[model samples]
Each structure stands twice: as C-alpha cells, then as structure tokens.
Target: MIHILYDRKPMLPERHKGKLMDNLIGNNLMQRSKKHFSMNRKLPRIPINRRFIAYVGDDFHFVWVLDFNYRYVTLQTTKNHHQLNLLFDAENRVFLDCRLVKTLDEKSRKGSIYLYEIINFEDALECPLSWTRTKSNKFLRKKPRNSYPVKLTG
Candidate 1:
C-alpha cells in the first residue's frame, strides 16, 4: 500500500505571507540596494608601456607609465620615492602637476607603485615659446642655489 499526502496551503509563516507572490509580480518594481553599486572610476584609463621621467627633489627618477587618463596617472619605479609630485616627459615636452594620492609597495619585486592625481597639465606643443621660458624660470627659482664652501686657513 502507498500513501499520498497533499497540502492545500504552503508551509510558510504568517510574517512571510504573500512574499513569494510579491517577489514574482514586483520583481521589476524592486530597486537595487546601495551595496549593488560600486565605487569604480567612471573615466576609462588607457594602458601604456611608456617610460617617463619624474623629478623627486634633486634627482630624476625613471618611472614606467603603467596607465593614465585625463585626471590621474599610475607609475611604477624600483626606488620608493615618497616626494614624487611632478612628472616631466621631456620627449613629449609635457609637464604634469600632480600630487601623490596613494602608494603600494611590492615586496616580491622590491618596487613601489605610485598613483598620482593630476592637478594641472601643460603641453609644450600647444603653448607658445614664451610660456616655456616663464615656466622654466619659475622652476629654476624653486631650485636651491649651490653654496661653495670657503677654504679656512689656520
């Protein structure tokens, strides 16, 4: 003998009443939660393998251009220089006024990755010759003057 059992109603609790029907009928009306949205950047970044020069204090550091956009640039270098605020591409004759936004140290490669926020961009190709002269003068004035040590005679 075989017994067949049949139930007329679902076994869900009273609090969950009509939730199944509501989900099916109102699926389109439901709005996505805030967590579903991401904090990803809106601008598309262009990947580049070009090497560029950046001025960190008195020494010029060789940095690889990993990627860039109009607002930001990502660079990689062997030396972990914290004061990397200016990126000067002599070949392109382009100057990027930037500030260090973040830094990641790669322990495996023993190198540092830097993400800089581009504050201002100046392209020599678009600017007049006079602009370059004034800009160069401004940079020169910022450099510290070399002080020669005087010979002391006893």
Candidate 2:
C-alpha cells in the first residue's frame, strides 16, 4: 500500500513540522490502506511513515524509490511532452504524463500522479533505498507526516 501526501510547503520554521504531523497525517492513511487491497494480493508490509523522499530532476521531473517486494519502482512527472520524452530517453522507462495518473477525489491539489510506464534497471546499479533529493531551495523534505500517493503501473 502507498501513502499519499502532496502539498507545496512554503518556507516555514521548524515548528511547522509538528503542526503538519499532528494534522494532515491521518486523513489519507485510512484511504491508502483501503485502496491498497485493490492492487495486489499478499500485501507487502508497508512502513508506517507518511513521507517519501523523491529526486526531482531538471524541469519538473521527479522520481521516488518504492519498496515493492524489495524491488524499487521509480515514479516521475514532467511538465511537457518534450521534457517527458527527454526524460524517457534518458531514464529508459515507460513514461506517462501526470495528467493520466489518477488519484482519489480526496487527494490534495499540490500535484497529480500522471501517466507512468515501466523501466527496468539493474539492482547492482540502483540502490534499493535511494530516494530522489531536490537540489533547489525547496527540498523534497520528508516530514513525519509527509507522504506520496502510489500510482504504480504494471
């Protein structure tokens, strides 16, 4: 099951973390758990943390590392077709626009899970737990209450 948390947090003081945790965490947790059953049998043991670390590349591209049976799924989004194709060629994964990625009605408006295609990579090359990090001033900060909705493809 994948937990989803999408919101642009303006630059705030450290105290905001506690407030975020106390409030936004519970709303989506129940839904993610319920929808997870719709995906697969023999449900994988998911960690309870709400935040996921993602790597944001040039343009609006972003990818996250997911623990799926110890295998990793790379999820990303791009702003335009050109950028998306460039990313697809570079990453060699099935690419999908964020527009096509569906989310529950209750999802936040911060970002959408668009189209997704599968890509194969050698485990020897990619670290199992390595998450994408934002290089910009806004980090893909994983707060205690932060999480990303999983929109995986076959």
Candidate 3:
C-alpha cells in the first residue's frame, strides 16, 4: 500500500495524497520563507495541517520529519520565486540532499510551475547536486516515479 506522510491526525486517505500535500504546503510562503531563513536550530513542532502558520525563527518552517527514527528531515527555504531544499543525512548530521525548485502554486497562475518530486534518498541527491536544475525541469516535462515496492512496510 502507498502510505502518505503527514504531520499528524486527520490524515487524508491514500487516494487524496496529492490534494493532501497541496493543502499542507499552501500559499503565503513568500513571506513565511523570508522570515525563517536564518533559523539555525530545531524546535518543538505541532502537527502539520491546513491551518498551520509558521512564525519567524521557527525551525519547523524548514525542518520536516520524514520518519520516526529522525533519519530524514527536509529543510525547505525560499529564494525569490524558487525554493532551496536540503534533506538531512542521518549518519552525517548534515543536509546533503539539496534542491532548488519552483513550487506549483495553482493560485499564482504563473508559467507552468517547476518542482522536483524527491522520491528517495538517491533521487533527492540527484535533484540538487547537479550544477543545473535537472529534476525541476524534468517535472515540467513529466512526473517522476515515487511508487513503493509491493511488500514494503512501515
């Protein structure tokens, strides 16, 4: 089964995963991103949902918990219209999976939004490590594969 990640309760069903993420990562980010750019540490975080609002110096704005082991955390920042992303390296204690992407904002009605859908650790690296934006552009062309194996479990 394809399980969708969330901050907590009131989880959306599998069929609504796309809408879930879209609702979770909503607009007003241009201002929120500017406020959290200098955050250097983590903090107590509430569960993520539609009404969640981020404040300045808030670590939760950028740091995302990917799993219970805390093995993966995503650091998503904004630079102008593009997003600067960094996925943590659990063993190294560093943000190694970096990316620069333009998020899809349906309300903006801008030219086709660009993004990099990071499926796994390898795809995460390939996304940002390139000198140019590879996956971001590719997403505009087509969607990337994020399906899990048949027997994988939580």
Candidate 4:
C-alpha cells in the first residue's frame, strides 16, 4: 500500500502517489522556492527558480522531502557539502532550494542554488530540529545524512 502526505486530509490513495507530485509540479500549484543571497543574517530577495537542478538527467538527483509546507520544505540531498536544502516558495511555480555549500563570512554561510522536486508517496510528517536561513542559502545546524537511501518517503 502507498500513501500521500497532506494537511487536513488522510492518506491519499496508492494510485495517486506518484502522480500527485507530478501534478503539483506540472500545474505549479504546490510550494515555491525562494532564492537569494544572505548577508548579515538578512535575506535578500532575488529572482526565484533562477538556478538549474544538477545531476538530474543521468544521476537522477532530486529533493526528497522529509518535511514540507506552503512556504518551505525540508529535504535531503544526494551530495556532500550539500546535505539538506530549505526550499522557499515565493510566487507560484517559482521556488528555490538553498543548499548550504560553504561557510563564508563570520555571520553568513554560502549556499548553492538548486531546483527542487517534491517526491510524492512519502510517509507521515514529523517536525525536525530548528533551521536557520540567511540570505539565499539553507543549511542544517546539525549533521544531515552523508548518503542517500535508495527510496525516500515522508
């Protein structure tokens, strides 16, 4: 059996699992990613969805959401120095997943930009630890998984 996660609704039917995510992205009805450069703990707004997603074609890299919301979603990445991403959505269909790439200044950290896709048919949602965002980059203060699993749900 499969299920889809959503607020105010019970588990979605199994058939709707994969198609749900595709529909959301295709219709651009779901969340959005806000990309910007952060300085002095201040987030600067820039063009959203301006960056292209890496390793998508051959490597099939994508965002596996561990948590999700209307404005932001917590997801796992497939590479090192790029563990978790905070996907911020401003306008519909325009979003950015700010991946913390490096520690730059004393107060701000550098983040890589990427296009994110929410994986459908995951598991029940649970709140994780607190995450901070400055500028356009999003990184976890705690250590994220070094490797990705074959299947990511919920």
Better of 3 and 4 by lDDT: 4
Q: What lDDT would each prediction earn against the true structure?
A: 0.64, 0.35, 0.35, 0.37
Which candidate tops lDDT? Answer: 1
**lDDT (Cα, tens digit) per residue for candidate 4, span 1-154:** 2434433454555456567778877666433453555544132222222323333323434444443332333334434334333323322223343444443223213332223233321221232212323365356555578755668689
Q: Which stretches of candidate 4 lie over 4 Å from their true place?
A: 1-60, 69-72, 81-91, 101-154
By lDDT, highest first, what's the ranking? 1, 4, 3, 2
Residue runs of model 1 more than 4 Å from their true location after superposition = 1-12, 15-37, 83-92, 122-154
Write candidate 2's Cα lDDT for 64-151 as tens digits: 3222322222233222122132122223332322222342223234333333322332332344333333346534454445466779
- Number of clashing residue pairs in every model? 0, 14, 0, 11
Model 3 over residues 1-154: C-alpha lDDT tens digits? 2354454567556565456666656655555677554633343332221211122322424333221112233222232222233433333433333233444434342223233323244543433322222335555676457655678589
- Please say which candidate is ahead in TM-score: 2 or 3: 2
Superposed Cα deviation of residue 113, candidate 2 (Å): 2.1
Q: Pick by TM-score: which candidate is best?
A: 1
TM-score of 2: 0.25
Residues 1-154, candidate 1: write the lDDT tens digits.
2333353455765565657868965775566433465747877776765677788777777778777765787888776554565445455466776677787556447367778777774452253433223224566567466666779999
